[model samples]
Target: MDTATLQHRFQTLLEQHRKIVFKVANTYCRHGEDRRDVSQEICAQLWKAFPDYDEQRAFSTWMYRIALNVAISFVRSNIQRERHAIELDESIDIAIDDSTRVHETDENVRALQAFIEQQDPLHRALLLLYLEERSYRNIAEILGISETNVATKINRLKQRIREHIA
Candidate 1:
C-alpha cells in the first residue's frame, strides 16, 4: 500500500488500541511529562514498525510488544528516570487502566503497584501482561519467552510478591 494509506490504517489501529500505549506509559513513567514523552515515542516507533506488521496476527498484541519495548528502553536510557524514582510508598497505587482490579483491597493494591514499580524492565513487562490477565501463550509471545518460562517466572513473581508484601 501507499504511504498515505499505510498512515491512515496505522492511525486507525492506534486509535483502537491506544489504551495499550497509555497503560504502558502510565505504568512505566511517574510524571505527566515523562508519560507524554514515552507515549509519543511509542507512537513513533509503532508507526515506524507498522509496515512490518503481520495482518494475520493481532494488532493489539503486536502493539503491546512494541510499546513495552519502547517503554523499557525509554526508562533504561533516561537518566532523569532515576531522579524521579520513588521508593515503594503507601501512595504507590498507580492504576494501570480502568480495568484495575477492584477486588483487591487498597492496601493490597498499593503493595501490588509498589511491587510492579520496582521490577526490572523485563519483569515489569512480564507482570504487566500477566496482570492484564493475558494468557500464558500471549505473554510468552509478547515477551518472546517460552510458555513454560512464562509460567515459571510468574510463579517466581508470585513468591516475590509475597516477600514484597510481607
Candidate 2:
C-alpha cells in the first residue's frame, strides 16, 4: 500500500482502539504523568509497527498485542528503577469510560479495581482485559497464552477478588 493509504488506515485503527492504550497505561502506571508517558510510548510503538500490521486481522487484536507489550516492558523497567514500590493516589480518580465502568461511587466496583491493581502485573493485565469484556480467545491472543490458560487465570483472579471483598 502507498504511504497515504497506510496513514489513513493507521489513523482509523488507532482512533478505534485508543482505549486499549489508556487501559494498558492505567493498569501499569500510578501517576498522571507516568500514564501519559506510557500511553505516548505505546502509540509510538504502534505506529512503528503499523507498516507490518496485516489488514486481514482484527485491528483491536493487533493493537492489544502491541499496547500490552509496551505497557509490560515500561512497567518492568519502572519497577526495577523504583525498587518495586508502587504508590497509589486514591484521590486522583482514573476515568473509565461510562460504557465499561460502573458508577465511581459503587463500593463493590471500587474494591474490585483496587484488588485487581494490587495483584501481580500479569494477573492485573488479565483482569483488566477480562473486565473489559474481552473474549477468551482475544485475551489469549493479546497475552500470547492458550485459551484454557486465559480461562483458568481469569477464574482465579475473580475468586481472589471475591475473597478479598468478603
Candidate 3:
C-alpha cells in the first residue's frame, strides 16, 4: 500500500481503538501526566509497529498488545516516575474518560483501584486485559503466555480481588 493510504488507515484504526490506550495507561499510571506520557508512547509504538500488523487479526487485539506492552515498559523503566507524580491542581481529565470506569466516588471502585494499584506491573497488565473481557486465548497471545497459564493466573487474580474487596 502507498504511504498515504497506510497513514489514513492507521489514523482511522487508531481513532477507533483509542480507548485501549487510555485503559492501559490508566491501569498502569498513578498520575494524570504519567498517563498522558504513557498514552503518547503507546501511540508512537503502535504507529511504529503498524506496518507489520497482520490484517487478518482484530485491530483491537493488536492495539491492546502494543498499548499494554508500552505501558508496562514505561512503568518498569522508571522508578523515579513514582515520586515525581505532578499533583494536578485540577481534576484528572484523562482518568475520567467515557470508558468502562466505575464512578470515582464509589467506595468499592476505589478499593478495587487501590488493589489494582498495589499489584506488580505484570499482574496489573493481566488484570487490565481480563477486565477488558478478552478471551483467555487472546490474553495468552497478547501477553505471550499459554492459554492455560492465562486461565490459572486469572482465577488466582480473581480470588485475590475477592479477598481484597471483601
Candidate 4:
C-alpha cells in the first residue's frame, strides 16, 4: 500500500482500537506521563508494522499482537534497566460518566490495577487483555499460547485477585 493509504488505514484502526492502547498503557505504566509515553511507543510500533500487515487476519487481532508485544517488551526492558520504581498508588483516571455511580467501580478498578501491577509483565498483559474483554483465542494468539491455557491462566488469575481483595 502507498504511504497515504497505509496512514489512512492505520488512522482508522487506531481510532477504533484506541482503548486497547490506553488499557495496555495503564497496565504497563502507573504514572500518567509513562502511560502516555508507552502509548506513543505502541502507536509508533504499530505504524512501523503497518506495512507488513497481512490482510487475511483480523485487523483487531493483528493490532492487539503489536500493541501487546510493544507494551510487554517495554515493561520488561524498564524492569531490567531498573530505571524507576513503580508506584501502585498512582491513579489511572479513565473518563467515566455518572460520577455519582463511579465510586465503587473506580475502587474496584484501582484495586485490580494495583494487584496486576504486582504481577510480572507477561501476566499483567494477560490479565489486562482479559479485563478488556478480549477473547481467549485473541489472548492466546497475542501471548502465543493455547486457548485452553489462556482460559486456565485467566481463571487462576481471577481467583488470585479475588483472594487478594478479600
Candidate 5:
C-alpha cells in the first residue's frame, strides 16, 4: 500500500477506536496531566507501529494491545518515580492540594472505579476490557492470553468483585 493509503487507514481506525485510547489513559493515570501524557504516548506509539499492523487482524484488538502496553509502562515508570520521591522526601510534608477534581457520573461508577484502582495492573486491564463487553476471544487476543485463560481469569475477577460488593 501507498503511504497516503496507510496513513488514511490508520487515521480512520484511530478515530473509530479513540475511546480505547482514552479509556486506557484514564484507567492508568490518577492525575489529569498524567492522563494527557499517557494518552499522547499511546497515540504516538500507535502511529509508530501502524505500518507493521496486520490488516487481517482486528484493529481494536491490536490497538488495545499497544495501548495497554504503553499504559502499563507508564504506570511502572510512575511507580518508580513515586518511590524515589517518597524516599527523597520522607520528612517533608508538601501539600499543594488542588480543589479542581472532576465529578464522576454517579456514586456507583466512582465506587467501581475505586475498587478497580486497587487491583494489580494486569487484573485491572482485564477487568476494564471485560466490563467493556469484549468477547473472550477478543480479550484473549488483546491480552495475549488463551481464550480459556481469559474465561478463567474473568470468572475469578467476577467472584472477587461480588465478594467485595457484598
Candidate 6:
C-alpha cells in the first residue's frame, strides 16, 4: 500500500479500534507514564504492520494480535515497568456506581490488578482480554489458540482470580 492508502486505512482502523490500544496499555502498564509508552509502542507496531493486514480477517482481530504481541513482549523485557503504582483518579471514580460501591469495586480491582501483575506476560494478556469480554473466537485468533483452549484458559484463570480474591 502507498502512503495515502496506508494512512487512510490506519486512520479508519484507529477510529474503529482505538480501545484496543487502551486495553493493551492497561494490561501491560501500572502507571500513566508506562501506559502512554506502551500505547505509543502498540501504535508504532500497528502502523508498521498495516500494509500486511489481510482484509479477509476482522480488523479488530488483526489489531488485537499486533497490540497484544507488542504488549506481551514489552512486559517480558521490562520487569521494573511492572512495579509502578496505579493511581485512581476521577475517571475510575466515574466508573463506580456510588461512593460505597466504588470503594468496594476499587478494592476488588486493586486485588485483581495485583494478581494480574504476578501472571506471566501471555497469561496477563489473555486474562485482560477475557475480562474486557473479548469473544472466545477473537481471543483464539489473537493468541493463535483454539477456541476450546481459550474457553478453558479463561475458566481456569477466572478460578485462580477468584481463589486469590477469596
Best by TM-score: 2
**For residues 1-166, what per-residue lDDT tens digits would candidate 1 score against the true structure?**
9999999999999999998998899788877788899999999999999999999999988999999999989888884656558455444445656766343347777788779888888888889888889999999989888999999999999999999989
Model 3 worst lDDT window (10 residues): 85-94
Candidate structures ordered by TM-score, highest first: 2, 1, 3, 4, 5, 6
**Candidate 3 residue pairs in backbone clash:** none
Q: Model 5, stretches more than 4 Å misplaced?
A: 81-107
Clashes of 6: 0
lDDT of 6 at 116: 81
Name the better of 2 and 3 by TM-score: 2
User: What's the TM-score of every candidate structure?
Assistant: 0.88, 0.89, 0.87, 0.84, 0.82, 0.82
Misplaced by over 4 Å in model 6 are 80-105
RMSD to the true structure for each prediction, in A, is 2.6, 2.2, 3.0, 2.9, 7.1, 3.9
| Residues forming the 10-long window of minimal summed lDDT in candidate 4 | 95-104
Pick the lDDT winner.
Answer: 1
The total number of steric clashes, by the backbone 3 Å criterion, in model 3 comes to 0
Tens-place lDDT per residue, model 2, 1-166, is: 8999888888888988888888888887877788899899999999999999887888898898888888888777777666235554556565678455445466776787678667777888888888779999989988899999999988888788889999
Q: Candidate 2 — which pairs collide? A: none
> Candidate 4 lDDT, tens digit per residue, 1-166?
7889889988998898787787777667766787888899989999998888888888877887888888778777787554445654533345433242233246676677668778987788788778668789988988889999988888999999999887
Better of 3 and 4 by lDDT: 3
**Residues 36-107, model 5: lDDT tens digits:** 998999999999999899989988999999999999998877786652121211232222123334345445
